[model samples]
Target: MRKKRRQRTILWCAIAAAIIIALLWTEQIALLYVLATLGLTILMLIVAFADLEGAKRSGQATDD
Candidate 1:
């Protein structure tokens, strides 16, 4: 279901953030790349969730 997918997305994002922080703590320059990638991914997820919520609202309105 959509809820499950959303939860998984959030979980993965958290995991990614944790990994990036760990790498950063170790003074790894590679963490910069990971941070950039994760930032873009989080942004995309936000957009997708916004769109999904809008669609769900419209669908519910139509059903009434």
Candidate 2:
């Protein structure tokens, strides 16, 4: 589970970095920064939720 979580985290981080770079190079749109910020915030929320779910599952396994 941990190994999977680590892989997911790395994947998300790489995706976020790639999106940020792409946004920077694409155009000079005023909302580019805002779009990047929103994208990052959503990615972080997803990663955090996955971590919480993993913890809950691990805890339940130990309890049983």
Candidate 3:
């Protein structure tokens, strides 16, 4: 599960970066920055929760 999660994380992050670059290449809209920021924030949240849950389930956390 953790390996799958890691793969998905990398895939989604790459996808997000591609989209941002595509948008930048096609247009110089200021909104693109906002969209990129939101995308990055979402990716960060996914990574954070994934690691936390994995650690907890594996009893790797201090409180576990």
lDDT of 3 by residue, 1-64 (tens): 9999999999999997888788889896687978868879999999877767666679854652
A best-first ranking of the candidates according to their TM-score comes to 3, 2, 1
Q: Model 1: runs farther than 4 Å from truth?
A: 31-64
Cand. 3 TM to true fold: 0.51
Tally clashing residue pairs in candidate 1: 0
Cα lDDT tens digits, model 2, 19-54, are 767767886556676886887999999987787877
lDDT of 1 by residue, 1-64 (tens): 9999999999999997887788789888776887788889999999877878777787784553
TM-score of each: 0.47, 0.49, 0.51
Q: C-alpha displacement of 54 in model 1, angstroms?
A: 23
Which residue pairs in model 1 clash with each other? none
Better of 2 and 3 by lDDT: 3
Model with the higher TM-score, candidate 2 or 3: 3
Which pairs of residues collide in candidate 2? none
